[model samples]
Target: MARLQSSGFFDLGDGRLEYHFVGRQPAAAPTLVLLHEGLGSAMQWGALPETLARTTGCGVLAVSRQGYGASSPVSLPRPADYLEHEARAVLPRILDAAEVGSGVLIGHSDGASIAALALAEGEARLRGGVLIAPHFFVEEVTLSAIRRTRAAYERGLLRTRLGRWHADVEGAFRGWNDAWLDPGRRGWTIEAALTRLTVPVTLIQGTEDAYGTRAQIVAARRSCPPGLLTVRELPNVGHEPHREAFADTVAIIAAFVRRVLEDEGAGEPHRPDGAPMGE
Candidate 1:
């Protein structure tokens, strides 16, 4: 895998956003765009994105959402409306600036939710997606994990460790933490929005995920069109399947990309509905 560093700023309707590109593959090769977890950043993905790109012979684009990593920090409270901004505003600008024609989106945790919403919103530019440990609805385990993580951030080692990579660790936590824990946010659900996505999708989750349950996975699959959904449940894995079961996770992504590419007949991959793949 190659290590490449690149950053760009693009203006969304609300404000400017920044993103980081990890690896650039042959133009003819597929592109793998990564959307990090809630408390994650480009650097936090560690080497998974690079390894996946190398294994699949594709480019890797890992973004630092508006308030995380090297991007601008969140100056205000993140509301339920924020996910819409991500689906409609931030993503398009990043894709345009990167000049990514078509690609697979690999999203983890909160990133998974954003990816689902993005697909639900419909983008002609994306081929398909790999959603890992995603949440479509609030679960007890999720609330428990958030509470535990909050405690860790407040008095445990998590904050110190994560702060090493995130320039605005507080902003990162606030954007995700406050929104989910808000009493009024318990009803937040993306199932309705996700059901509209007609793209081929591979949902990856761990049987032992600390933050979500099987029901979340069921909801995600049920939201998709029949025959367009694939689910991989890794045993003894947790929230970060790509890291906990790195080899298996990489293999799954490689297979999905290959399947889509082959179905494209040496051209662009297509959605389950037979729409051309690309942005």
Candidate 2:
């Protein structure tokens, strides 16, 4: 039998984002807001959300950003700062309109980069972050993989596979692909924002990941408050650690969220100034 899922759109006025609110909510616990990968959507997360919510007793709100999934398409040839722009302009509004209030951010790939940006910019709604295969800065490996994928996209396989998850597949593909391939975007880095973030962050990536190196986590750890950061390298895993090593990934994420929330509840300052970051 086919299972039916219920979902709705968050009308942000500027854009309508496809999202689904499901899983357990203990009231005392914060929600787990999930951001999908570049070509991902609310549907691409598969059963991970349900599994996490059940295990952690946290509410789960999975968002499909504009130009991906069922959400509206964005303007073409995205700015070099689109990820940062998303953090500053779009995510906060989504949090506000979705009534997410506050939550832990669990993001993958491009989504992970966006999560770090949101944390850096100080999303009061974000208590912590779980970044998987996050690219803090562009690298040769990153472009190489993307270029290879672009070739595969031209062969029709990539587009066909991504089409299953995206509503505007071409828009999503071009928006993410073209922006990264732009020469000017090579200098882009969200590392500077890390200095402003004090939240507990778990940076997990597989050693086998072709797109980015462990240096991605190293950069984050170097930039973020040492005491607030955790780095985990999953051996034998690929880019999608959460999916490749589901049990370990979920456990690490749940523990990080719990510990951070407990410390915050016990009155530890989330930021050095005893105020939210990015004032």
Across 27-108, the per-residue lDDT of candidate 2 in tens digits comes to: 4346788988887888788788877766666667888999999998899988888888888998888777656655889999
- lDDT by residue for model 1 over 20-60, one digit each (tens)? 56544425456788888888887677778767655665678
* C-alpha lDDT of all candidate models, in order: 0.78, 0.82
| Per-prediction TM-score | 0.89, 0.90
lDDT for model 1 comes to 0.78
Instruction: Evaluate model 2: give its TM-score.
Output: 0.90
Tell me model 2's lDDT, rounded to 2 decimals: 0.82
At residue 226, what lDDT does model 1 achieve? 80
